[model samples]
Target chain A: MTRLAGRIGRFAWEIALPIVVLSYWWLATADGDNPFFPPASRVLEAFWSNWFDERFVSDFLPSMARLGASYLLAVGIGVGAGLLLRLWRPLGEIVEPLISFLRSIPSAALLPFAVLLFGIGTNMQVFLITFVCVWPILLNTMDGVADTDPTMLDTARAFRIGHRRRLTRVVLMAAAPRIASGMRVSLSVAVVVMLISEMFASTNGIGYVTIQAQRTFAFADMWSGILMLGLLGYLLNLLFVRAERLVLSWYYASKGR
Target chain B: MAPLLSVEGIGKIYGEGRSAYRAIDSVTFDVNESEIVTVVGPSGCGKTTLLKCISGLLPPTDGRSVLNGIPVTEPPEGLGIVFQDYSRSLYPWMSVAHNVAFPLAGKGIPRNEINDRVERTLAAVGLRGQQRKKPFQLSGGMQQRVAIARALAYQPKVLLMDEPFASVDAQTRAELEDTVVALRAEFNVTVLFITHDIDEAVYMADRIVVLTPPPTTVSEIVEVSLPFPRDQIGTKELAEFVKLRSHVYRAVKNRWDDRQPGQ
Candidate 1:
């Protein structure tokens, strides 16, 4: 019974902020004077109506599909590039400046160029999302690989372990915690880029629904779409954190001690 | 029979021209098959440089080191090394068993044979039940034992150690010293152990080679005539052990004086 109460206390601690925010929104927007702010009940009603509509399914699924595709692509290409940069010093030196310059350019600013290049299809959305997400993963992975302990490398050498096996067994295993951190950062970036790309050019996606509702003066629907996007982002982040905890339990335990 | 390993007029100089620093100057030593040879010296006297040259980890500037009649061009096969820092010497990600099994993986040993050898070697080091524990999980002494197990599992003809117990507590160091003595007796493997501690050198070595300071050379070689199955208290209290320890201590002190700035 004590353990159960402790768990409930922990649950309350986690949800406290969200509950307070919801309560404030209900209280503040009850008189409906503000054009920008909708009451919690009206937003909930709008959410239920749109959530069950068949047309809304098409937009939401396509946006999620695009996010998945872009995130996977970014991870694959970014990790591959990171490995290349780490293994080859001269190549890394040559490309590092260019990669830094590219990363400095705001990702949202690339939407216009992305639309011109990919012509406002699913491809454009994916390209933009990949562009925004790849930098964090690539930089983090390279840093991770570079920071792998030299002593461990020497240990591998003393044992006569070959280069390929050494890299796989020692270097990568040592770099895992850093790489997980990078992936978590990239996941949030992927979601942000997904919505931004849809807002800028896409005909189908949650962003498009939001844009349509705003243009049509459907204030409650617009608020509902915004709330859904925020919820989706929060859920994605939570999922990444959970996965990181599961996969890197050893790293966490070792670091904690 | 010829010595199991030989080093002839080995010299190592770091850098070149005006900046040149001579570490070992024409030093020579050899280890007979199944013999334990310890090199003792004061700090900065190039005893470690000599061991590095012999182990083929670093090439001597002007001389050759041969193992089994072949000149060592790289870290030669059938030779293993245990460094002082146990934290740096073992891969943290690998289990103790895997760390022990590491060196043998290249010899094309069957998987079962590798497991058998790792288990046997860990048992020899008194770490049998801790196979799955990572190196970081173990105590410093236990980690060093894992290092010893790794070197032993390699089944090397020659093992080189660089002040392997300098960092451990006195009690743990004594225990590890006994473990080495027992291992040397069981395996009959040649050892080229390097240390700055004269007492440790005298206690563990069959023959202790004392080195002179920088631009170092062999100053003396003291044969330990003490009997085997040695205990720390009993062996250290022996009259001969005390005499030899003092002799090594003096030799190393003289070298330090010789390498003094004005000398």
Candidate 2:
């Protein structure tokens, strides 16, 4: 019972500052006649009117779909390519300059190229998000794979484990902590790139709705979209952390951290 | 009837001319089936290099080692190695049972047989029923036992132990030494053990191979005629055990002194 009461107290303390800031915003804008700065109440009202209906299905679902597909694609390709490149030194060297060149250019800047090639479809949007997100996973995987404890490799080899099992079961798991760290970084990148891709090439997503609200000067609607973006980013990170905890449970347990 | 492992004139050199370093000049020995042999040398006498060469982990620049009638150019089948650094060698991601079973995955053994072998091997190392725990959860001594269990589960024709008990406390080290001796009787596996401890070499080996320091070569090989199931207290206190220990100790110390700059 004390533990439960303590948890409640902690939760209230965590929300205290946010609630105070919210109240201050309400008091400061009580007159609520500004075009640029909508009162928190008006923003909440617009959030309901804009998002709690058809736009939720037409706009929000599409944004989430694109984010989901591109993020999965990036993680899969990143891990596969990372393993192959690290395992084979020559192959990694041959593509070193090409990877550098691609990584150097902001993936958002390639939006024009993406649109020209795949044309503002879901394909173009996905290409941009995946391109941006994959770099972190791939680079971190390379470092981790390269730095696997040599004694572990020696032990596996001495035991006559097959090449395939050694690579997948031994090498991959050894590199997982670094790979997971990179993945966490990319999850945030996936969220940001999802918005950028939608703002540029998307015809029907939350990013599109937000941009549309801004263009027509629906200030309350735009504020609501911004709030939703923050909410969604926070939610996606929470989900990623949960997934990370599950996959790397042994890692944490072994370290007793 | 033939020797199970023959480390015949194996040698290793690091780098090329001008900056060259000769780590092992020529190391030669033989271990017959089910026999235990220990190699003891002063620190940095290429004891590790010699073991790596024989186990086929590192390529010897000169000569070759033959294991079970096959020339060991690479890590051969029918061999298991337990490195001294037990913590790093055992996969932390794996449970103790999984770590033991990992090498058997590609051996095409049936599931039931593999489980049985894993359990039996763990029991041999005195780690039975602790299979669900991770390696880090165990003490250093227990962790090395898990490593030993992992090796013994493979049922290798030969087991190469590279100073495996060097990191454990003295009491645990003594227990592990006896465990290996006892397991040899059970498993009938040929063993090539490496160590810097003279007492360990005398206690655990049927024969002791002492090495001279760098450009390292076998200085002497002394046979230990002590009886099996040797006790830590009784066997170590035996007159024959002390004489053999001193003989190997003098051989190792003599070479160590020869290599000293101001001696």
Candidate 3:
């Protein structure tokens, strides 16, 4: 009983500030006289009704699917290209300037161009997110692969471990921590770019719904859309953090020592 | 009879044209089958370059190293190396057991046999029950033992050690030296070990090859006929050990002293 109470106390401690602010919001806006701002309870009620019934299926799920697909594609191609460039130095040197130029162009500026190229749908959304997020992943993986200890390479060579085996076992494993950090940065980029593309050109997705709510002056519904986006970002980050812990446990364990 | 390994006129030149620097210069030697040969020299005397050439990690600009009657243009199948920096050489991400088992991954060996060999090799290095521990979790000496176990697990025809005990403290170094001696006898593997320490050279070698200072070549090769099953205390106490130690020490010192002005 004491342990359960202690656990609850700890949980409450974590949420204390947020709870206070939320209570303040509810009380201050209870009169409902404000034009733009709704009471916290009304926003929550709007969120429960709209998201649970229809908007979640149409807007939220499609947005999340785009995010997942784009992020996974970026990781796959980024890691592959990074390893290739690391192994083949001349190619990296030649392509690096072009990569820099491409990454430097603000992704928002490229949305209309992407829309023309792929047309507005999941394709345009995935293309935009992947294009922007790939840079961090590729560059980080390249740096990580290049920085593998020369002595370890020599050890692998000396042991007669073949090129393929050595690359996978020695180089890839050595670079995993850096690659994982790169992926985290890419994840946020993926989420933001997905939202941006959907807002600019798409007929569906959470961003489109949020904009639609704002245009209609359904302020509580707008708040709910904002709430869903925040939840999506937070939940994705939570999942990524947990996965990273498992994949790079060896790296963290050694660092802890 | 042909030597188990022959290093013939090996030389390594870095850079090009005016900036070309000769790291090794026509160094030559041979290791008999199952013989333990140590190369001792002053620091920066290209001892590592010579070892790298022998192991085929670095291609010599001239000449070649032949192992088991085959030219070592690349890392030969039956050769193993234990590098000096155990921290960098052993994969920190791999457990002690996996690191030992790595070299045999695609050698058509069964998984059970590979595990058996890993277990036996880990036991040989006195790390028997600690197979699951990662390299960083072990002490410096124990990490080196894992490296040695990795080399031993391969059952190489010759083992090349590049100052493998330099990082460890005196007690661990002494213990590791004994382990090498025992492993050498038990495996009957030829060894080409390099160190800057004359005492280490004298202690471990059946014959010691002393190389000159930078742009190095063999200055002398002194034979050590100390009997087998040598201990840290018992072996060093012998007059023969002392004599060989001083001889190699004087040779290394003289080569460094004899370097010309601006060299």
lDDT of 2 by residue, A158-177 (tens): 88778899998889999999
Q: Can you give the TM-score per candidate against the true fold? A: 0.91, 0.96, 0.96
Could you give candidate 1's per-residue lDDT for residues A122-199 as a string of tens digits? 998898889888888899889999998765765566567788787777788888888778888889888888888888
Winner by TM-score between candidate 2 and candidate 1: 2
Query: What is candidate 1's DockQ?
Result: 0.44
DockQ of every candidate structure? 0.44, 0.84, 0.82
Q: Could you tell me which 10 consecutive residues in candidate 1 chain A have the lowest summed lDDT?
A: A150-159
Quote the B-chain TM-score, candidate 1: 0.97
lDDT of 2 at B130: 97
Arrange candidates by DockQ, highest first: which order?
Answer: 2, 3, 1
> What C-alpha lDDT does candidate 2 achieve relative to the native structure?
0.90
Scored against the true structure, residue A73 in model 3 reaches a CA lDDT of 94
Clashes of each: 0, 0, 0
TM-score of chain B of each: 0.97, 0.98, 0.97
lDDT digits (tens) for residues B76-117 of candidate 2: 888999999999999999999999999888678999999999
Docking class of 3: high
